[model samples]
Target: MLRLIAATLCLRCQRVRALPANLRSCATLSSAENRHTVEALYNLSVDIQKIRKLKGWVLHQSPVYVREVADLLKDMGASGAIVARILALHPEAILCSPDQVRAQRELWMSVCRNQTELVGIIEKFPASFFTSSSHHVNQRDNIAYFQSLHLNKRIITKLMASAPQSFSRPVGQNEVMVCTLQQAYLELGGEEANMRIWLQKLLSQNPFVLLKPPEVLRQNLLFLRDKGFTTAELLRLLSKLRGFVTELNPDSMRHTLAYAQDTMGCSEAELRGIVLECPALLYYSETILAERFQGLLGSGIRMAQIIETPTVLELTTQIVNYRIQRLRAHGYDIRTGSLKPLSGTKKDFEMSYGKLQLRRERPLFNPVAPLKADD
Candidate 1:
């Protein structure tokens, strides 16, 4: 009977051992189901976030936070039913408040004890899990948060370097105008073309230059009109131009002086002297100067008076000759005179003639009578 009792005890112990094994198998299955369910939910969240991005919603938080939460749920080893129940109890509670996240981290540490692998997993969870702070709402704050992840500093630097400097000061309106004018001036050709371009550019840049637009036009008309440019054309051109001084080229001044001399029927030498003495007048060339000279002369204006008082006689002679030539070329009757004179009687000539006549009369009277008497 004692032997029978011993066999029975052994059988009971064996059954108890089998019960523990069955419980362990059930727990393992539950843990695997919970992991699968959590993974699915996390995947769904990711899909939603992606959709939000496609819809142009700003993702202010780091993606790693979501992933870390999913990983933690996977490591929990809870049953799918239990996980579903937990999620249902507080639908969005997986994302803990900052304070709650910190508490959870502390609890995880206590539960994990000195397990290195568990500690590693806890460390991998996002810092956001420990704080409810919405610092990520700001892009700069978000960048700082990412840097805290021990990412490569070089990568951050490179990203910053690649970004455009949008904060730099914008070009001023005045500066823009100046730049535009400069470009136009460069594009135009010839002296007149250049002047037009320059004037336009200057005016466009600074409207103040044309404070008296009509007056400016009148002045330009008067000046250019005198240089043989048609008054109407001068008016049209000045109306179109903007800046006066900025468009003035030193070389253009020379050409203008030449034109003025030509129009005024003045010699090149005289024009050059005038330009040297009064540089302001050298705005037209010989052609224009000549035309102007004929106009003035036709109006019965005297050349001597028009040429400044300081001009030498030689310069006046040149001016006269140039005027005569131009007038003749244009089919106008022009009379010219030389500096020298033709043969004419003078007081000295008469005195010399009288002396010669007295000498000849005395010789004829005295010599002729003696010769006849001697014969």
Candidate 2:
């Protein structure tokens, strides 16, 4: 019966049921089979209508293996609602034959501890599990390659779920990028014992780093070195950026630096200090920096104040305006005062505001405060 269902749901529904003997091996689903597949999907509580609207081809080009796919997910311990959501979001999962899906499942299971973990990953990133069958060989090879490096199985599972493209590439390509990162870590004075954990954190933070060309990383590191970031400082910056250092290129970095220097009228050393204090300065584009600078300057904030607390640039113009308005309403003058009070996350801002409000409301006599201090 399972084989019968698999044959009935084959994608040959899109093809004409006529041809040579070898081609005849593929079955063509009649209207009855298509209706049955749709009905089965509906019975599974799948939003079949939503899927049809989102991917109309599911109705004509593909009458999917609804039962086979749902059963596979169920065996993996996915609840009925999750199974329905996955199918509704990515109806193409039912396009693959049962054999192909089982093969994919086995491949994923090699990295995953069990079917339950795999289902959790699928729930978060449905497309990662439903990648093309053509990449299965590459995926298998890459999993073995990562294992050979002795990376934690948990990290490997994360790479598969969050950055499946890294596994879909040929093993040789990923091997080169991995080697580049390892060499960079060693050259930056990273300890041998810490390398494994560092690599795991890097991959977990930005698995897409594996997809960057090794040369880009080399060039970016060289550019930073020229800009006077020592080996230790480079390592710290890389960690702070969460492995996104590879995402920078020399030209863009130069452009952002030039903008900062010209606008703030700061020397290279001062600019470097600012970047170390607020690494976002290194990654934000000239346009974004300009908008933020203008917002502060327009609000009567001095360049000297920005230099003193560069982190305020991390906030958007609208946030800066809102915060400044709130501070002004409380009779605080940010233009003359330090930007430190405005330079952190929303919770930090709220804490600072609370303190300011208390100060404003406190009695000058402070009778309770003096008694408490004496006590």
Q: Estimate each model's TM-score.
A: 0.18, 0.81
lDDT of 1: 0.40
Candidate 2: where is the Cα deviation over 4 Å?
Answer: 1-33, 325-333, 347-375
User: Model 2 over residues 1-375: C-alpha lDDT tens digits?
Assistant: 998877876746535343333324434434533655665666787776686568756755454688998898898899999999898888888887888888988998888888888998888888888888899999999999999989999999899888889988899999999899889999999998998899999999998999888999899989999999889988888777767888889999999999899999999988888888898788899889999999999999999999999999999999999999998888889999999888799999999998889889878885755454553
For residues 290-365, write the lDDT of model 1, one tens digit per residue. 5655654564545664565322222233454554454444344433322111001234334544554555456535
TM-score of 1: 0.18
Error of 1 at 149 (Å): 53
lDDT of each: 0.40, 0.86
Candidate 2: residue 65 lDDT (0-100): 82
Residue pairs clashing in model 2 are none
